[model samples]
Target: MIELKSAGELDAMRLAGKVVATALRAVAAGAAVGTSLRELDEIAAGVLADAGARSSFLHYQPGGAPSPFPAVLCTSVNDAVVHGIPNGYRLRDGDLLSIDFGAEVDGWHGDAATSFVVGTADQRDLDLIAVTERALAAGIDAARPGNRLGDIGHAIGGIGRAAGYGLLADHGGHGIGRAMHEPPSVPNEGVAGKGLRLRPGMVLAIEPMLVAGGGDSYRPAEDGWTLCTFDGSRAAHAEHTVAVTSDGPRVLTTE
Candidate 1:
């Protein structure tokens, strides 16, 4: 069922969203050459602890996952697309890192993801990250009331197609509220005017996953959590949790 947030519930979501945003910022800021992925996970866990927030990703096991996620952060490095497990791997110069994080506060859930480079980034990697962020912004822009859910995906997918990037449309965004994932599967590629109609209080997480290579295929790594690209090409992912309002769209997660 698609649940709408009341004013008080929206306030609760914002509080949870702020915790996620702050933790993401902390994790991103700690992404440096020679920094271990485990270290980044620690940074996120520390932030959540201080804010009285609990990690939604930790111990979360979906159907496809081999086991419950053990860490607070999903640290995808380079060709590792999404759901990357944080481990003892150390960051290197020119490595592109994508951190997907979610947190819960007072029983409300907030989620977001960001992609960045560790040190001196390659121009190709820089362009990919920029494009992913723009796609996220475009999706958020189309979240106004009266718009269809497909419009959000259409706007995001168009950018990737125009740039000749491979999109992971199969694993797109989803509705998020009291739980980490919910109804209304928001695809990254769809007809602009199709899918569920947007309305006030309907909150959705819009994320765009783009790969530099032609293939969109990925596989689960041996770690039982990370998803890696089939051809070993780098990928970028960016996301924001937004709510449709009577007047327009209200973005709840922002730094």
Candidate 2:
């Protein structure tokens, strides 16, 4: 069932969002050339521990998964799109890294993701990340009362399509509340004025996953977790937890 959060519950979720934002920032800053993905995971764990928040990604076993996720953060690099398990792989210069993180505070949950280059970035990769971030902002901006869920998706997809990037299929945003994944699967592409109508208490995580290969084809890695583009092209993912309020769309996950 879709659970509409109250004012107090939104506040609690915002607290959790703050924890997630801090952890993401720390992991991004610590992600330098030669830095192992495991080390970046440790950096996020430290931030969560310092804030007395628990990781929502750690040990999370969604249905149909091979095993429980073993890391605090999803570190997808280069071709890997999402759910990339953190390992001992050391990042090289120009490696595109995507970090996805979630945190729970006082029973509330918040999730977000960011993608960036490790050291020296190619101009094409930089443009890819920039457009992905813009898509995320557009999605968040569309989360307002009287707007349908499709509007949000349309806003996001329009940007990606205009840039000639491929939007990842089958994986999109979701409702976030007491649990990490809730009801209402938010799509990254749709026709406006369709789907569920936006309510004031609704909170959704709008994420845009874009592939630079200009196609939507992707395959799961041998590990059964990490997803890579079929053409081995790089990808970028961006997200934010937004609250549909009367005034405007309030982005909970921010630094």
Candidate 3:
């Protein structure tokens, strides 16, 4: 069921959202060439700990999964798309990195993701990241009360299609509140007038994962968590948790 958050609940959710934003910012600032993905995870874990926040991803076991997630953040690098576990691998120059994290504060949850270039990024990689960020913004802008969920997807899809990037349809965003994932799945592509209608007090996470090659497919790595592009092309992902209000769409996970 779709739960509409009360004003008080939204305020508490904002606290969790702020923590997520802060953690992502700190993680991004600490990321650089030669930095290990495991180290990045540690940074995020520390931030959440310092804030006295609970991680929504830690030890989270979704259906069909062999085990629970073990990290505080999902670190996807280059060909790896999403759910990339942090490990001992050190980043190299020109590598693209995607960091996804979620936190719970005052019993509410927020999730966000960001993609960044390690060092001396390639122009094509930079462009891909820019496009993904722009697509996310477009989707967020479309998340006002009375707007259909398809409007959000259409806004994101238009940018991806115009740039000729491959949209990863398998994974997108979801409703976030007391739980990290909830009702009303938000896809990256859809018809403009279909799906659930947006309403005040509804919060959603809007994420767009784009690939530089064919929109073909991906596979799980031997690690059983990381998802990599089947064609070995670079990928980028961006996300934000937003709330539909009487006024407009408010982005809760902003610094």
State which candidate has the highest TM-score: 2
For every model shown, what is its TM-score relative to the native structure? 0.98, 0.99, 0.98
Question: Which digits, one per residue and each the tens of the lDDT, describe model 3 over residues 1-255?
Answer: 999998888889999999999999999998988999999999999999999999999999888777899999999999999999999999999999999999999889999999999989899999999999999999999998888999999999999989998887588899999889998899898789888999999999999999999584888898888888888999999999999999898899987
lDDT of 2 by residue, 66-111 (tens): 9999999999999999999999999999999999999999999999
Which of the predicted structures, 1 or 2, would earn the higher TM-score when compared with the native? 2
Please write out the lDDT profile of model 1 over residues 1-255, one tens digit for every residue. 899889789888999889999999999889989999999999999999999999999999888777899998999999999998898999999999999999899999999999999999899999999999999999999998888988998999899888989887478999999998999898888898998998889999999999988578887788877788888999999988898888677778875
True-structure lDDT of candidate 1: 0.90
Arrange candidates by lDDT, descending: 2, 3, 1
Number of backbone-clashing residue pairs for each candidate, in the order shown: 0, 0, 0
**Candidate 1 segments whose C-alpha is farther than 4 A from its true place:** none
Scanning candidate 2 in windows of ten residues, the lowest lDDT window is 246-255
Candidate 2: residue 220 lDDT (0-100): 96
Name the runs in model 3 displaced over 4 angstroms: none
Relative to the true structure, candidate 1 has a C-alpha RMSD (angstroms) of: 0.9
lDDT of each: 0.90, 0.94, 0.93
Ten contiguous residues with the weakest lDDT in model 1? 246-255
